[model samples]
Target: MNTTPSYRTIAGDGLWSNNLGLVQLLGLCPLLAVSGTAINGLGLGLATLLVLLGANLCVSLIRHWIRPEIRIPVFVLIIASFVTAVELLMSAYFHQLFLILGIFIPLIVTNCGILGRAEAFASKQPPLPAAADALAVGGGFLLVLVVLGGLRELLAQGTLFSQAHLMFGDWGRGLSVTLLEDYRGYLLAALPPGAFIGLGLLLALKNLIDQRRAAVAKAAPALTTQQANTP
Candidate 1:
């Protein structure tokens, strides 16, 4: 029995089955707060991704040196350090976006998702696997952020990628699209309640897809046996 997990399994779990935003539902505070627009979500998501990558790799590298008694604190310190670095970098380069994100930038340190990955998978895995896990998990979270943000933004303002210049340069100013010229905005989709509702809908959609896949897999073998016995 090959007890070792494959990269496909790790990626599958991080991207879909065990997603931070959709499945595990970790880091919802930041996820919901900054996801008012696609750019806001993209900004925060990239920052979180950077921190996760750095923290996971560092934790995996030093796993052997850390004492079991103080591992939790050690992992937190590592995550905090990476979060600080990400915050500073964003402030310097994406100043406008940074100011908009405000305290949430530093709050990434408290994100249970990052800490959970460090203690759960990173601590036990090698550097390569740890980094891969971080990428997969972070990517999954990023996808949800961008998708939710875009949906909210479109519903509320009839625009996608509004204020693109905040992240991209002057050229990005042209990226925003006015999908609805005379469209009346929906106020609810722009509020906190909207975030919850949107996320719930997304969760339901994912569950529906998963249920369909499960049904198909279950029927496959039985169908094969029936066909073989028929003729």
Candidate 2:
């Protein structure tokens, strides 16, 4: 009755092969909206991950108790509970980040990646695997957000971790790196339109990398067999 996925499989699916932003293409709204800076993306990503982690654990524990007919609703309610907790925490500690991210923080409740996992993986798997899956998936999502945020911030303003204090308070202000002191910022890269452009370019880069890896994998077996036959 154990439906736990292997660690490799879980990691691959959650981090790369089935990522929410890059692969599955879920949660695009916040993925593109709040990622104007590294801290913004990191904050939201952490929130989403926290909610996913708690939701998956809760769903796995109650999976058998809920009737099949109302399972979806039950799963949603569970996710909402976690989202509420996450929202409150953010509002309390990272009040500045909470204001900047605004509605996106609360909207984590509607992200399909969360609900999809609850129904597909967590509901069927044991608690340990479910938690692992959530971690992998959330890590992947957070990574993409961070990378995207970094890309935009660096390209637009020639800085890294700009406005990090919003998340880390006074100490975080010191972490902001000024890569280009006099660099004129790129207007497009600082706007919402820029997120789409950056994301598209990132997708192209990922696809190129994937294609090269696939080709290499495909050629390896053929080359080995040919060498063996020749000998």
lDDT of 2 at 31: 94
Error of 1 at 173 (Å): 1.4
CA lDDT scores, all candidates in order:
0.94, 0.93
State the lDDT of candidate 1 residue by residue for 14-117, as single tens digits: 99999999999999999999999999999999999999999999999998999999999999999999988898899899999999999999999999999999
Tens digit of per-residue lDDT, candidate 2, span 1-231: 755679999999999888889989999999999899888899999999999999999999988898999999999999999999999999999998999999999899999999999999999998989999999999999999999999999989999998989888899889999999899999898899999998999889889989999999999999999999995
Error of 1 at 162 (Å): 0.9
TM-score per prediction, in order, is: 0.97, 0.97
List where candidate 2 sits over 4 angstroms from the true fold.
none
Clashing pairs in 2: none
Q: How close is candidate 1 to the true structure, as a TM-score?
A: 0.97
Clashes of each: 0, 0
